[model samples]
Target: MNYVLALFLPPLSILLIGRPILSIVVFLIWVPAIIFSGGLTHPMFILLAWILIYQAHQDRRAR
Candidate 1:
């Protein structure tokens, strides 16, 4: 679900993945990146969100 969510809302997905601080930071950068770069940088944030989501899942499994 988060993987799908990341496509459209990476920062929200990151927050859902349990990275409040990083999500705030990403939100700060993502908005401008999306605006100034004409969405060219969106995929980067999506990828970052996906990685964090995956890591969170892995951490849960480890525990």
Candidate 2:
């Protein structure tokens, strides 16, 4: 299903790519995906994605 795929793909891709910018982009992409998929009730998951993105950016800046 598109909803399931959308939910998983962005995070997985970010993990695979290992890039902060890409992960941030992926997290941004999830906004619309969640909206259209009617998954906004799972806001915590979105927050987790944001946390990952933030950590990635922090790591990049530290390097």
Candidate 3:
């Protein structure tokens, strides 16, 4: 679900994963990067979100 969400909305997915500050930073950059670059930069954010999601899951498993 979140992977799919990350594909579409990386910042929101990141926020869901519990990183408000990063979400804000990604949001700030994602918008213009999308607009100007025509989504070429989107995969970067998606990858970032996916990594964060994976990390969060790992953290839960560790705890």
Judging by TM-score against the true structure, name the best candidate: 3
Off by over 4 Å in 2: 9-41
lDDT of 1: 0.80
Candidate 2 residue 1 C-alpha distance from true site, Å = 6.3
User: What digit string (tens of lDDT, one per residue) describes model 2 on residues 5-47?
Assistant: 8677656656654666766666677777687878763565556
Best by lDDT: 3
> Which clashing pairs does model 2 show?
none
User: If both were scored by lDDT, which would come out higher, candidate 2 or candidate 3?
Assistant: 3
lDDT of 1 by residue, 1-63 (tens): 843443349878888988899988998888777667777987788789889988998999999
Report, for every candidate in turn, its global Cα lDDT versus the true structure.
Answer: 0.80, 0.67, 0.85
Report residue 24 deviation for candidate 2 (angstroms): 19
Q: Over all chains combined, what TM-score does candidate 2 have?
A: 0.43
**Considering summed lDDT, which 10 consecutive residues are worst modelled in model 1?**
2-11
Error of 3 at 23 (Å): 0.1
List clashing residue pairs in candidate 3. Answer: none
TM-score versus the correct structure, for each prediction: 0.84, 0.43, 0.85
Each candidate's number of clashing pairs is: 0, 0, 0
Off by over 4 Å in 3: 1-8
Candidate 2 lDDT at 63 equals 100
